[model samples]
Structures are given as C-alpha cells and as structure tokens.
Target chain A: MTTMVLSGNEACVEGALRSGVRFFAGYPITPSSEIAEEMARRLPALGGKFIQMEDELASMAAVVGASLAGLKAMTATSGPGFSLMQENIGMAVMLEAPCVVVNVQRAGPSTGWATWPAQGDVMAARWGTHGDHPAIVLTPWSVKESFELTVRAVNLAERLRTPVILLSDAIIGRLREKVDLPPSVPVVDRPRPAMAPDHYRPYAGGPDGVPPMADFGTGYRWYATTTTHNERGYPVGVDAAAAEGLLKRLHSKIHDHQDEVVLTEGRWLEDSEVVVVAYGSVARSALAAVKQARSRGLKAGLLRLVTLWPFPSQLISQVAQRIRGLLVAEMNMGQMVEKVREASCGASEVWSVARFNGQYLMPEQILDKLEEVRRAWR
Target chain B: MALMRNRDMVERYFRRGALPTTWCPGCGLGTATGAMVRAIDQLGLDADKVVIVTGIGCSGQVYTLLNFDGFHGTHGRALAAATGIKFANPELTVIAPMGDGDCAAIGGNHFIQAARRNMDITAIIMANQAYGMTGGQYSPLTPMGSFTSTSPYGHIEPPFDMCALAIAAGATYVARGTVYHTQELVRLIARGIAHRGFSVIEVLAPCPVQFGRRNAMATPVDMFRQLQRATVSVREAELHPEAIGGRAVRGVLREVEGPEFTAEYEALIRRAKGDTHG
Candidate 1:
C-alpha cells in the first residue's frame, strides 16, 4: 500500500499501532528505547494511553493490568530490563493476560554490551520465569519482518490469552531498511464471553481452548490470582487435581494448536546436503553463506526460524533425514545449536557457528563453518 | 416467622465459602478488613464497578474474601496493577491493599511514582510493623530498636512515616487510622475512596502472633491498648511535639486539590480526537 524506510524498532511500533494496541507501558533502555519513544509520540495522537513506568517491573505489571481491563497492551525493553521483567511475566502467564513483551536483545549475562547484537535471550524467553508454563516467542530477521511479526505476536497473544514475546536483536532493531507496509491489515481481538453475566466463566473456553475474557468494570466480576485457579477465575489451591488440570491446560492450549503457533521458512532444503539453521539477524548471513556455498557447488541450504519457541522441532526432524549435516549459527555461544542437535537426533551432524563478542556473525564466518561441515561429511 | 432471613455484616460483603478467613485471631487485619467493607458499603459503590488489587502478603489474601473484580498478584506490585486498571477503565473504582513491607520496601518505587502522578486510586497500607505472612520478618515499618525474627537483636533502622512519605510524594489525600478506632478508619477509608486523586489511608493494624509476641506486647489486648495509648490526635500532635516521640499521628494529614490523572487523561483523549467542546 505504501513504501517507507524505517528501522526495526520504528516498524515495530508502527506495526503495534496498526494491530490495535492502545495501551503501552515501558521504561527506557538502549536498542529498545525507540519503541517506547515512538509509542510516547504516536499514542497521544490516536487517543491511546502511553506511560513511562518507574522501572521495568512496574512496566510489565501495568501491561498486565491494562490487558485485564480490555485494552490490548504492550511493553518493550532490552536485556537488563527484560531480566527485571521476569517476575511479572510469570504473573501474566498464570493469570493468562493477553499482552505483548518486546525484548530487542543485547549481549548480556548482565549488561554485557548495550549497543551490540546477540541472541543470548533465546532460552531466557522460553524459561526465564520461575515456573513451568508455555511461552510464545517470535523472532524476526529484517525490518519488514520485524514489523509484520510484531503484528503477528499481538494477534497470537490475544487469541491464546497469554503473553507473547517479539524477540529482536540490536542488529535488526537498529538497522534501517526500505520496505512496503500494508495500508491496512486484519486485526484479531480476544474472544468475548458468550455466557450471561451471572453464568460467565472467565477461564472456560470452547473447542479452541481459549476462554472469553471480561474487563474489570464488566458485570462478570470475578477474582484473578497468580495461584492456580478454576474455570470461574477463583483460586483453587490445595486441590491437586485442579492444579494439575490448570497447568496442563495452560501448556496444551498452545501446544495443541502448534500449527497456528509455530512458523518457519525453508530455502533450498529439498536436495541440499548441508543445511544452516539460523534466526534473527544472523539469518541474513546464513542466507548469504548458503548462496555462496551453492555457487561453489557445496549444495548448502538455509532454514530460518520465525517462531523461536515451540522450537519448530517437527520441521527440523522432518528435514533432518535428507540433509547430511547441519550448521546452527547464532550470536550467542551455541544456545540454539543444542535444540538443532536434539531435533536432528543424530540423523545429521550438527555444527555451531556462535559469536558472542558483541559482534554480528559475518557471512564469511558462516561460510567457513559450512565448509568445515562439508569437509567432515565428505 | 417475622422475617425471611438475616445475614452477618461480614457475610453481606464476603464471597460465600471463601471465608473462614485465614487471618490469625487477635490479628488486626480482620478489623481492618471490616472497616474497608464498611467504607465501601457506606459509599454505596457497586461491586461490579469496583476492583481490589492486592500484593503478596497477609494483606494480599483480602481479595479472596470479598466479591468484586479482584486481582491477587505478585509481591509489591498491587499499585502497578491498580494503575493499569484505572487507566483502562477510569469509571471503575480501583483500590489496592498492601502491607508495610510490600508497599514501602519491595514496591516502594511504584508507591512514590503513583503518588507523583496523582493516579486516581486508593491504597490501603496495612501498617502491622512486620511481615506477618512470612513468619514475623523485620520490615521497613518495624520501629527502631524493636525485635523480630530477622532482627534477633533490636532493629536499628527507623520506621517509615507512611503518611508523611505519601504527602511528600504528592498524594492529594493522605490519612492515618488504626484498627483500634474502627469507626475513624471506616470514615477515613470512605473519604479517601471518594477522592478523585491519589489517596492513601495507612491503617496501623496489630500483628499479635508475629509482631506483638516478639515485642513487649504479647497479647492482642496489649497491642490494642498500646495503639490507643501511643497515638495522638492531629491537633494534639501539633500542640505537644515534645510528648509525641513514641506516638503516631492520627486523622487526615493532607487533603488538597489537584488535577486527577484519569480526568486529565479523558480530556487529553477528547482533545486528541478533535472534540473542541470537551
């Protein structure tokens, strides 16, 4: 509909606005502050609410609260802020609030490098919170993909009644690119309660397993807690079976609908002997290396992951049989290589090309790894 | 029979079978809860139009006993949650119940910022002087030279004057009441709820089993008597500064006019939407 040049963070904010996000709460941090700054500037024009909370913890808590009150809410942060957000992230999961959390990741165990790129938070996004709950994480490799995937993240969050993380890194987040964005896109809203005021079950769903939500002022006044709850949204502590059922349901709602939740893109995997598994910013390099290797008669392929969590294990398992070897390239010290290795199940050799010195993985570096894997296979 | 049925006062507001409350007997939390219910009852607020958010603590469990749009959530984040609720639905009356430790220590940033923003919400800080739910840990509100489980020796830190902190942080309505004076607490709470700006009513409740048993006040009656003896009226406190060292100030400490957050936000929305008349 329209062509424009925008950075990944700018497109992220634009996409969120287009996706019906009206409430945004955030604390400023590097590489992700543009999302908050953009939200503050644009939200007022649209009559939406934007708040700069005192810290990341409150920012997350506010998002959960706003989502409960029936506005699609979001928050953004980098590594340290994302780490501080873990406590309330668990709360959002337990309460099943629909909100988006964007973590434009930077290199860090603790504030390692503020302005550099790294996929160090891949596992943290999945298991950072203190409990066993399902997570939906979407990773994007380009400015346009960041915009599009952010919109997708919001939709999935509302549809599933859970928190969704849009995992971007400094490389994609700061890099500017020209792209065509749609004039309008389809916006999906959470299901509304079908039952009467007196009979509404806020946590009960139909065949889809996602319950209709009610806002605070609605007549369906019910209690929500971090503790295990029944269908009526009341805490059902000490009842072992009820707790088990609730936990199982929370995981199954996302797992059972894997077709909708898991998304990936495969390039030249049909007849290639070497496949490179990559995501986020590093995927671009992997693509470059794949093309170079193909030109050199090495038969290399690229499998770029769009949805980082739910692992896309089925896809890897399916393609593992045909490929002789796989190279997993990322910005961290081999976080996702383990997943590829496990999914391959030894059908193919899994090699890692990880760089964590606050730098992006180069195409040549990826090509070098692919050459090594090719040599080993021969 | 003369009439159909009569229910107990607490039962009139509490959720059915959600009671047999877990609060310790001789704990002032029950009395404080009763005052809160009476305040809401006196204000005649609709249950469907109210939301009670609680942080993790003994105070956090209050939501389960009452019928309303309630959220019992993470430690020290009740105000943050309440802030969101009020922003989303400005017409709804949002209230948060938090403990001294939960509000002043863990959630201190939110408390200060919420007041600074003058957000339209009422926060009831239960000043029991110790962490009751966690087995009598030393809290930010524990009096100087007082003993608790964590402070096996006398606590060296001075307690926070919650009302003063709230007033300094720009709360429009700030007050202090004790469980010993239930009627006053109900009145203060109701008035705070009626205010359209940030309001705080700090209730000096007794934690007999956790705080009192560790300190010199071993019995609930002793705690109540101490509350009565150590508290001075607002007028008396101003007049007799010398004798007010060990005494707590009671009554409204601050009530002033200011722009309410929700009302201002509504006007912003109207302006943004190009509605000139608003």
Candidate 2:
C-alpha cells in the first residue's frame, strides 16, 4: 500500500491497472485525455498495452474486440466522443463482452466547455445506446471514490458480462486528493468455460445469468455477433422466440441483481423533513447544504447516489416514504431529477435545482431550493 | 472436385453444419472463403489460434462459416476490431475479412492507420467494387462510369486502388488476386498470414446478384471471365503501365519486414520495466 496525491483521472488509470486491465484503446478527449495519457505512460511498465485509436467509434470497437480475446480492456472519453461510442456500446451489450468505458464528462450537446464540469450525461449514460439492454453507471464523488469505483466498475462488468460506465465529471476528474492506494486490489477476471470445447454453449451460464466466456485461441472455437442470438452465440435471425428469450435474460441478469448493483449513501435520513438527492461532484455541495440547513435549525438530510443505473429506485422509494420533501441538485438542467421524481411516486414533494451554464451546482443554490421547498410547505 | 471435397483440409476446416452459407449461388464470397481456408491449410495454422473478424456485409459472413474463434462486428469496423484482437494476444493469428465498402469507405481511416502501424494482422479485403449486401449501392470502390442502384447514371467518383493505398500506407505485405484465380489467391493469402507485419490481400471477387445484374455482366461466368481477361501480372503492369486501366495487377506488390507494432510494444514494455535482457 502507498499514500499519494492523485487526480480522479490518474486514480482511474491506476485502479484499472490494479483491476488487471491489460489493454486500453481510446481516443484523446479533453478532461478525459489524462486517463489516456496516464495509461500510455504506465500500462507499458506493467506489460499492459495502450493504443491511441483513430476515433471513439474504433476505440470502443477495439475495446470490445480485446475483451473478447480475453483481456480486461477499457476506453475513456467525454461528450462528443461518448456520443460516437453509442453504436459499438450496443454491440458490447449484445455480445455480453466484459469491458469498462469511462466518461470524464464535460459540458455539452456538441463540444460545450471543454475544460468545465457537467453532469449532463447522467441519463445519457443509461440510454445512450439505442436498445432495451441494461447499463451500469457509477458516479464518484471524490478522487478516492474514483479509484474504488473504477475497480468496482471493472469487476461488475466482468461479473455481469456487460459494459460498465464510470460516469465522472471534469471537477472530480481533475481534482487532486491524497489517499492510500493498495499495491494491488482484488481483480475479478471473467471465468472461462469449463465445459467441453466441442459442445460448449457460449451464452449458457450457471446459476447466474452470465455465461462463462472463452478467449480466442483457447481451443474453444465459437462465434459471436451483435445480432440477437440464442445460447449458441450465432445470429438468431428472425427467431422471435429466441430473440425474446435472449433479451429477457440480458435484462434480468442485471435487474434481478439490483440489490447488488444499486449503491447509495444516506446522511441524516433517520429523521428529516427535507432530503436532497444528488450525485457526482454535486453531492459535495448537497452535503454542505444539508449541514447548513441543519445548522439553521431546519430538518434537512442528503441522499447521495453512488450508482446511477439500475436507478437505486427501491432505496429512493423507501426514503421517499419517510421524508416530507425532496430536492434534486445536479450540474445539468434536469436529467436524473426526473428519475428521482418518478421513484418518489408522490410520497413526498420533489423539486430539482439545476445549473447548466458550465458550472457545478453550489451549496448556496441548493440551500436556496431547500428553503423554497420549506416556505412552500408553510 | 469430388476428391478435393473429400480431402482432410475441407473436412477439418469447414463446419459442415454452418455450410450452405448465406451467400447466394455464384457469389464470389464462397470462392474467396475457400481460398482463405486453403491458405490456412497450406500454412498448417492451428484453427484454435486463428481469430477471424468480419464486418456487416455479404463478405462478413465468412467468419460465421469458419469453425474458428470468430467475431462478426458492426458494419465497417472489422479492421479496428482486428487490431485490438492482435495487439491483445500476438500469439493468435488475427484475420479480418472485409468488403470493399467495409474497408475502403466507412472504415477507410482505420484501414489506413492499421497499415501505417504495421500491426501483425492479415486483412483479406473482398473488393467487389460495390456494396453487395444492400442491393448494389455504389461505394468508394465503385469505378468511375459504373452503373449501380445508387449510381444509376454511372458513378462520378474515382475508385481506390487498394493495393497502392496499402503500399503507400506502409503495409509490409501487399498483394491482389481475383476470385477466378483461387489457387493464386490461396498462395497470396498464405503469404499474408505468414507476414510478420500488416498484410492486405485484395481479392477482386464478384457480387453477381447485386453488381453483375446491374452491369452488362449478368452471368457468373461473365464476371469470372472479365477478371481473367483484365488481370495483368505485376511485371507486365510495370512494363506497360498504360495498359493497366480497367484491370488489376495481380501477385505480390510488396513484401518487406519492418517494426511490427505488437513486437515493438513488447520491447517497450521490457524497457519500461527495466528488463534489460528482453
């Protein structure tokens, strides 16, 4: 173990290496470029490989390809690059390849503020790729959390046989912090098929929905495609029943395990009238506002979402039943707030505090929203 | 023909169940695939050690038909995928089988860069000069004044000379063969697979259903004979460059060893780790 000061992007690369990532294919994008640059510098020392792909599309395609070849692979990007990755991300979803994609988010619909922070990709990270497939997105509130979540993202991707998105922002990505990073963390490599090579069903798993994967050149000759396919991994073409079964399994594999996938942290929730829901760097501001409200003798609490996808809806719903009002604060105009409102199910009054002018939400702004909600109740 | 079908190479390499491929009858994809199989057989390469990557198109179906570790990726990204597969495990012989449009049009940048890196991967490009799977759309490889569905008034764009493009991009091995010359194609593909750096073998195969029916060459034999007549030897092409239009120069255009990307990457890792002996 060693203590060192590191930025979120640097921690991400270190955590990827500790998670046994041996292959990285990515295009350089601002705020996220540090992840690629660090990977290029450090991966070689560990005998891992780094490649600067031509674009995000190829970077994602290459990551999927490397994962299928039995390597833990990753790619980092932001904004426009993330948009370019949607098609191949769908491919990774359909093929059930275990890989991580890091989006060090910057402001934009199209290259908006390159060096600034934005939480605009919260919803986009889940539904960015066009399909009904499940997405796993993790938000790191601090630099240390960035390292932990990077490792968690890789493990979850390997365990579930799917792509995991480490949804970060420019603030956390560039923020430097001192913390203890272990020399090595526990790595969860995808299990290889133990079945006979000739008779193996590539998409058939054990009790879990994830199937054991075989690397290329491992004597397990099989096929993989992005099309809806059966257990055999060949294209199912127009087999409606097969497609239905495949899609159902893919969804259930994640949804059925939501207890394990969804992560959240609650502060002052035991007894509170108003609760603020926040994620990413905005969570820091949210905690401060909750403390300020408490100092002013107002019963306020905070609910921080560490995992953005699979929604952690059950926890939100449960908390909604206890609290009187909820305020959602984020860097975007309103993305995850809609999810917060839907999950609350009218049990509590839900409102959003948004900031999209290329700035993060401040604690004072969140405190103002909390005060407004309190006044409305009077 | 019966004896050849009974040979161990065919029985061992082809997955009989996956046979009767998705390709139409008289489609040159079948011949192109056969040549690739023959090439692997000639090299005595282990099937388990071969990873075939293909993109969306009629040519992309080759990976599915072969009994090897295969990846049928998204449209036009086969080479990009192959680059990762090769770099991840240099022990495996990575092969990307792509269509004219798959490699030259949508994936053009990846194609040029992959060659530029001199990565150790074999790329077999089936240059049918048109998008065969999508009802004969004109592609970047579609020759000037060629009529197709998208170019009903004849194409205005000039086609890419694939071998020349690869050669200029620093491919260590560059060659061209027509589907009509299956034996020669087999030899060229074998050489490509054996090359230590990036190798591209462009097979001028025919897309009878999409391309032939649109042009005057309606029959499979017409397309085959056209290839036979238009192909000139590399020596003949150099001696009489003027007569090379509307034709392909066959045989190995370039074969030279250089710093292969994966090997260089390994050496870099050794140096970074202070493994001076490596």
Candidate 3:
C-alpha cells in the first residue's frame, strides 16, 4: 500500500479512476468542485474524458448518456446542484443507466451554505427524483472510506444497472487524511448480453433482475425511454401490469440483493444498553464518542451505517430489539432518525441528536445526548 | 417503381409494428421525420453507427418509429445527452430531435453550449410554434401575438430567432427548411448530418390541430399553403429582397469550418499522454 495524504474529494476521484470510470461530466459546485477538478486533470492522462457541463442537469444527463455508450461515468455536485440533477437522475433510473453521482452535501433547502457541512440531503438522495424508484446511497465518514465507498458505488451501479449516490458531506469532502491506498481493487463491469442482437431484450434480466446492457452502436438497436417500459425497453403506456412489474423489478433488484449492497461497521454492540446510529461524517464522531463512553464504563455502542438507502432495516430492527435506547446522530434535522424509528418498530426508545447549523454534530453533543437518554432509561 | 423503392427504404429504416404513430392527422412532424430518414439514407450511414436522442415532445417520438438505437430522455435535455454520447463514442453519429419548447425554453442552455463547444451532433429543432403534446401552450418559438392555449390574449413575447441564435452561439452549420419543402428539407438535414461540427436544422413543421387551428390556417393543406407562400429560398430572398417581404428565408443561412469537440478532446488526450506530435 502506498501512503498519501489526500482530501475526501480527491480520494473519491482516485477511487473513480481505479474503478475504471472513463467519463466524468460535471459542473463546478462548492465542496464538490475538487472532485471535478481532479478528474479534469487525471482523466485525460489516462485517455479518459472529462467535460465541464453547463449545469447539474446536463452533467447528470451526460453521465447517463456516457454510461449508455459503454463508458463508466460519474458527476459531482452540492445541494442546489443536486436539486437540479433530480429530473435527469430519474431518467437514469428509468433507463437503468449505470453511473455514479457524488453529492458533497452542503447546507440547503436551496443554496444555504456553499462551504459548510450538512447531511441535509439524506432523504433527497433516496427520493429526490419524483418516482417510486429504488436507490443505492453510500455514506463515507473519512477520507479513506470516501475512496473505498466510491469504488463500491461505481461497482454497485454497474452490477445493478442503476445510478448510485456517494453521499459525502462538506466536512468529509474537504477533510484531509493520510490513507494507505491499495495497488488494485476488485472492479465489476456491467453485464453484457450473451444473446445475439437479433433476440436481445434490453430490460430482460436474468435471475439477478439486472438485464445485460448493450452499448450504443453494438448492433443491439435497443430502445431506452424515461417512461415506464416493458422488457423490450419500449414504453408500456396504460399497461398497469407492465408498469407495476417494471417498478417492482426496479425496486426488488436492489432489495432482494440487500446483503451485497449494504455495508456497516459496528463497535461494542454486545451487552450495550444504548446504541448510537449514525452515518457520514457524524459517524466518525459517534465512533469516537462510543469509544470514549466505553472507556468510562457507560456501555455505549456505535452502528456506523455505510449504506444509507434500502435502509438497513433488518439489521436496525435486530439491534433495536436488543438495545435499551437508540440515539440517532446526524448533521441534519431528524431525517434518518425518522427512518430509524420506523425500522425499530417501537422496539426501543429512539432519540435524535440532530444539528443543521452548517456544523458537524460533535462527539460531545452525541455523548451528552447518550447520557441524557441513559439517565431517562434508569 | 418509385413507390416500390420508397417502400424498401421505409422497411429498411423504420421499425415494423411501430408505425401508425401517435401524431395528429396532417401533423407536419411525420413529414419532417420522413425527410430526416431520407437524408440519412442518402448519406448511406450504417444504422448501427447512428443513435437518435429525443427529448420529451411529439417530435421526440421520431426515434421510437425508427429502427436504430434510441434514448428517449426527459424534456429539454436531448442535446446534453447527445453531447455525452458523442464524447463517449465518437464513432457514433448522434442526432437529436426536439420540439420548439424542448429546444428553446427548457433546453436552451444546452443548445447554446453544445453549439459553442462545436460538438459533432445534429440537432433537428422541429419548430411547431407551440407545445403540441400539452394542448398548444405558448412556447419561446410561438410568434408574437399568436394565439395558444395559455395565450387566451395574444402572446406578447417575440419568438426566438433560433437560426440566428445557433449562428451566434458558434454552430458550424445552420439551416432552415419547412415541411412544405420536403425535398429541400431532406437536403438540408442530409447536409447538416454531413457537417463535422455542431449543426442545427430547424424544420418549420405545422401543428395544424393545435397551432394552425388557433390561427386562420385550420387544415393541414391550409398550413402547408401558408408555409409555401410565406417562405422563400435564401438565394431568392437575397436577389429580390423587396418581393420576399416578410417571408422566412429557407436554406443554409450559415455554414463554416470549425474545430470539432470530440477530435479536439482526442488531441487533448494525446497531449496529456505526452505525445509531442499531438
């Protein structure tokens, strides 16, 4: 392993290159600009293409187009840009175009803070696009994990034939850390059609529920549309059964393969009374607080979620049933906390230690909340 | 013999069982699309080497009717998607078919930027004056004082001069042809596709049911007659400016050589790889 000091955004770019991403179309947005800048410098050297698109929507559309044309592609943005990206991202979902979208989240309902950290886009990552679609969202807490999860994000996108979100915050995006990078990592390319172009159906999946994708100009002459489409990739207007089947398959393809898609890190969960569930940068502080609490004999544990969407429900339910209280810590105003509560099913007392003041939820704030919850439990 | 040859061309270029399109009776989109197909056939480009990227509009359905790889994407983003396709695989010919609203309103930024970049893509803006799919809403291409669904009072804003916009935005090739002039439209589209840089072929198609009904020209023939009477060849317009009056000039308005984006990017890649010759 080679040791290098890099920011989270730079690490993400490195990871994308390592994952065989050859095309990057992005607009410069705060906290995410470093990713685009690094890509612009690095891609051409590797014979890859990098384009600075006009806006987030165009960036996303370009990524989808590149993906369809047989190149692994990516784009990065912040909150306001992320909002602009939703429509095309929905098109990506409908078309099942495999690409990675990295939102280095900043504070915003709309352009709130360009340079500060906030995990306010958790829900947006899942349902920002207007549809009942499946989403794969990965949250990275550290610079090293940013690299690791970006690789995972691209791999999952290709494997599932879906767009994946690498949700990093401004703090994690800009945080510099010394990381020991591996020489090579496992890479997964999208499944290619085994059937001849004459008989190939674009949306007809094998057992995996992900159809083999054919690149444009590959003699498949396939059709892809943003409308609800049949297995042949043609729009099935007013065919309720076909639409339902398509929607279900789009969803079940991710949910059925949950074990492969979801990743988490747990610390001191055995014999713990209170568990702090957190993700992204807040998870770093939560881990530290859990360790500090353990040192003080407080029986605090941590569940650091690496996969946020398809929301690790079974695991959360199991943990909730075993724990006395669950404290959800995040840099947003009680977004994932609601998901936690829903997943817990009232099996444990759920409390939220939330903040959205363009600041990180500190270790002390989480520990204090843990203590308060523990006091109430006693 | 001509009918048999046309049938063969249609069979080779269009998808079987996809016809009887959802277009209104006498809609000029079909004629424009037919001209485009004829242009492609005349160029003798391989079907596998072409991809049609369509935006959300009636014109966007052109790709579905043709037997080629297609990307039917969201509203106003066809050019953006085509840009990506061309960058990813420069071997493929990218064509985008968009409506007036799709090209000038929501997708206006992408259109200008693509042209400015001199990307190798053919953009066919089917200017039907209003949004036909959504029941004739006023669009940026709707003429000033034209009646539309939203313009119960006459539309107050002047329509965009799209050919001028394309030229100013650095399009290497720009042309205008109406559906009434099918042969000229085919020639313009063919030439636009042959151009190596960004090309814009704005086909003035008529939405007889929506746009034409609101105006005096209610029938398809009426609209076609109006188009034929109201447009003149660019050469004719230049020679007899007084006789041309307010008629739209129909021909290649601008064609110039410029550096194509994908080739430039390839050279950039070579330079980045330390190739001195690049």
Candidate 4:
C-alpha cells in the first residue's frame, strides 16, 4: 500500500480503478471534466477503456452499455451535463443496471459557475432523473472521503443492482487530501447468470431482488429493456398488474433491508441543546462553527451526514428528542434542509442557513444563524 | 409472401403469431427488413450477440419481427441505444434502423455523434422521405420541393445526402441503396454489419401510404418503379454523376479507414490505467 496525497478528482479515479472500473465514458465538462480527462489518461494504462462521448447523454449511455457487458463502468459530469444525463439515467434505473455516476455538482439550472464550488445538486442527484424509482446517493465531504465514497458507490451499485449517484459538490471534488492507495481494493462484481444457457432469464431475481446479469456473447439468452417487463425482460405492455409488480419489486429491492443500506454518523449528541446537521463541503464549515460555538459555551453539536440519501430520518428523529434548537447548513437555498426538517420532530426549533447565490456556506454564515436561534430563546 | 418473413433468420426467430404485418401492399420496409435479416444470417452471428435497436415508426415493429435481442427505443433514440449496446459489448452486432424523419430529424444529433465516433455498429436509415408513423409530415431527408401533409405546397428544405453526411462525419463504411435493389442491398447490408467500424446504410425504402399520396406515387409498385428509374449502380452511378446526384446511388459511397470509437476508447481506458494516451 502506498500512502499519497491526492486531489479529490485524482482520488476518485483511484477509487474507481481500484473498485474494478474498466470502462469510463464521459465528455469534458468544467470541474467534472478533470475526472474524464484523468480517466482518458489513466484507464488505458490500466488496461481499462475510456471514451469521449459526443455529449453527456451518450457518455452516460455508453457506461450503462458497458456495465451490461460485464465491465465496471462509470461517468462523471457537472450540473448542466448531469441534466443532459437524466433520461438515460432513468433508463439505467429502469433496467436496474449496476453502474456509478459521479456528479461533481456545481451551481445552477444552467451553466452557472463552471469552475466554482457549490453543493446545489444535493437534492437533484437523488431526483434529477425523471420517474419514481429507488435512488442511492452518497455525499463525500473531503478528498479522502471522496476516494472512500466512490468505492462505496460502486459497491452499493452492484449490491443494490442499481445506478448509484456519488454526489460530490465541487468543493470536495476539487479539494486535495491524502488517501491510502492499496494495490487493489475489494470490488463486488455482479453475479453472472449461473443458470444454464437455454433456461437463462434476464430479469429473474435470486430471492434478494437482484437479477443475476449476463454479458452479451456469453451464451445466455439475455433480454433487457427500458419498458416495463417481467422476469423474461419482454415488455408487459403497461398492464396495471405489471406496473404494480414492477413498482413493488423496485421498491422492495431497496427498502426491505434499509438498515444495511442507510448509514449516518452521530456527533456530540449525548450532551447538547443546539445542533447542526450538514453534509458535503458545507458540513466541513459547519463542523468548525460547531466547535467555535462550544468554546463560546453555546452547547452546540454537529451531525456530519456522510450518506445523503435514504435520509437518516429515524436517527435524526431520535436525535431530535435531545436537541431543542437546530440549524441546517447547506449550499442550496434549502434542499437537504427540508429533509432535515421533515425528519426532525416539532420538539426542536429547526432553521436553515441556505445559500443559492452560487457560493459555499461560510462558517460565519452558519454561525450567524446559530446566534439568531439562541437569541430568540432569550 | 412478405419479403422480410422470407429471410432465414427472420423466419426462424420471428414470433410466429406476430406475423402478417400491417405494411401497405408492396411496402419497401419489408424488402429492407428482408435484406437486414439476410445480412444477419449470412454472417451467422448469434441472435443474442446482435441487438437490433429501432426508433418509433413502422420500422420499429421490426423489433418483434426478428429473433435477435431487440429494443424498441423512443422515436429517434435507436442509434443512442445501439451506441450503448454496441459499446457495452463490442462483440454484439448492434443495428439502428429508423425512418428518415426518425433518423435525420428528431435524432439528428445522435446520428451525427454515432457516425463521428464510428462506434462499431451499423446504422440503417430507412429513408422513405416522409414521417410515415404519425402522419405524412415532410421529413428532413424528403426531397426539397416535394409534397407532403405538412408540405402540400411542396417541401422547402434540401434533403440530406445521408451517405455523404455519414462519410463526412467519420463512418468508415457508408452506402445507399433501395428496396428495389434487394440483391445489392442485402450484400451491402451484410458487409456493413460485418464492417469492424461504424457503418451507415441509407436505405431508400418507400413509405407507400403516406409518401405515395403526397408525391403522386399511388402504390408501392409505383414507388419501386420510381426508384428503378431514379437510381443507378454505384459503378454506373459515377458515369451518370449528375443523374445519380439528383436521385439515389445504389452502392457503397464511402469506405475509408479511421479510428473506431470502441477500440480507441478501449485503448484510452487501458492507457489511462497508465499505458499511454495517443
């Protein structure tokens, strides 16, 4: 194992490669383009493949296709590019293909701040792709964390047999940190269809809701489609029964064992009246603010949420019973704040320190909000 | 009697009960579909190893009409899906078949990208020159000054020279032919599928119902007759350059060497793993 300091972008490449990613397809988009550029340089050296797709749509599709062919595949993009990837993302989800998408989230409904850091896509990463389906989102707060979470993203994708989104805001994506680079990391590849060639069914799940996959030219009679279908992968023609079954399988596949899937960290909860909940880069600033408030004898604690989706609601609700005043700090106007609010019981006072002006949430900005909540109690 | 159902692969793999298509009598899609299936069978590619992706239109129904792994993608997205399928497994014989409107209009961006990437697949554009699926709207490839439901006063846009566009965009193998030229069409299609790089076959299949009425070619037979008179062999096509330029050229128009998107991409991936980036 070689311990070296690596930028978040470089670390992401390291993580993906270690996690068995053999195919990467992406177009150069600001902030996120480095991921592609590095992949363009590194994948080939590692005996992997990288493609500069014509655009984000094709980039995303190529990865999906590669993953189906039994390669660990991924693509990276920023805000505008991610928007272009929505339709194909839905297709990946519909087909339940195992792949990872690294969204080095930037600001805007359009090309707002191309190179600037913003955590605005926190919510979009979970819901950007149209249609109702299960979403797995992981948020990394630092360069080291970026390396770790990217591997987790691929593992979750294969474990869940679904498209996993590694939502790294531009701050974490561009920041540099030290990571332990092992010669190899444990990567969980999907189970190939162990069934014989003739009886192979494409969408048949093996009790745990994950259908064993088979690559093309592997002598398996495989079927895959974006349309609603049954175990055989043929379109079931929008029948109410078929829709219900499809939705049920999609829902159960993720929800049945939410415990293993959902993870959150608890901080300073045993003795505190005021609390702050944050994720991504904002969580870093919020941590500094929490320590400052503690020095001021303000009785404040910070809950650094590393996993952004499957929203730590129950644990949040449990934490709510102890803290009275809470502040949620995030880059967006109030994206994840709303989730924190919904999860917190009315016993606590919850307020958001929001930023939608294409900027990060400064420690002072969040500290100011904490002061307001404390003074109001007076 | 369907030309398509007669093909060996199409005959063996077709959903037996799904046959007897709704195509108008003498519809050219049947002929082109026949050529495509013959090409597939002649190569002896495995059904699962070849995925046929089709966009919304009469041609999309060909998904069910053949036995290979098929995807009936949204209108104009056949090439995009085929891009994914082919790149996913460079071994898969992926094909994107769509009508003129589906390929040259709604899906124009994807079409150009696929060609430019030379993404190791065959794109067969069934250029009937009209939006035959929804209504008789004029398509981008519809001959300029031609009549249609949307162009009752005749079309105002120049038809796309699909083969030329493909050649310029970077497809290594580019050809154009019509259903009337079945023998040549089949051979060309087979060659295109067997091509190691991206290939575009602009098939001038006729849409009898929608286009026949608009252009005063009342029957599929009339459409075929027009093709026979308007088209010339790729060899003879050079002799009558002016005549062929105004009509169809039934043969390979471009076959050049270039980097294939998949091989280059694979090479890049291997290089990125620390090999080299050329």
| Fnat (0 to 1) per candidate | 0.83, 0.86, 0.84, 0.39
Model 4 over residues A1-378: C-alpha lDDT tens digits? Answer: 889988888888889888888888888887888888888777666677777777787777777777776788899999998898887788788877788899898878788988777778877778887778888888888888788888988888887788888888778887887777777776888877777977777777668877788775565645567767777776676577877778788878887758767766656878889889988888889988888888887888888887777788887888888889778888877888778788886867788888877777899888888888889888
Clashing pairs in 1: none
Better of 1 and 3 by TM-score: 3
For model 2, which pairs clash? none
Please write out the lDDT profile of model 3 over residues B140-253, one tens digit for every residue. 999888899999899999989999999999999999999998888899999999999999999999899999999988999999998999889999988998998877899999
TM-score of chain A considered alone, across all candidate predictions: 0.99, 0.98, 0.98, 0.96
User: How many clashes would you count in candidate 3?
Assistant: 0
Per-residue lDDT over B1-278 for candidate 4, one digit per residue giving the tens place of the 0 to 100 score: 22334645545766555567767776788778878888887777777677777877777777766656666655566777677667667777788888888888888888888888777889999888888877879889888888899988888888888888888778899998888888888889988998888899989888778888778888878888998988888898677666666666778888887788778766655544555555
The segments of candidate 1 whose C-alpha lies over 4 angstroms from its true place after superposition are: B1-8, B238-245, B271-278
Name the 10 consecutive residues with the lowest summed lDDT in model 2 chain A. A203-212
TM-score of chain A of 3: 0.98
Q: Between candidates 2 and 4, which one is better according to DockQ? A: 2
lDDT of residue B145 for candidate 1: 89
lDDT of 3 by residue, A263-353 (tens): 9988888778899999999998999888888888789999989999989999999999998888999998899999999999999989999
Q: lDDT at B35 for candidate 2? A: 86
Q: Residue B181 of model 4: what lDDT?
A: 84
Score chain B of candidate 1 by TM-score. Answer: 0.95
Ranking by lDDT: 3, 1, 2, 4
DockQ values, each candidate: 0.75, 0.84, 0.89, 0.45
Error of 1 at A325 (Å): 0.6
Candidate 1 chain B: worst 10 consecutive residues by lDDT? B1-10
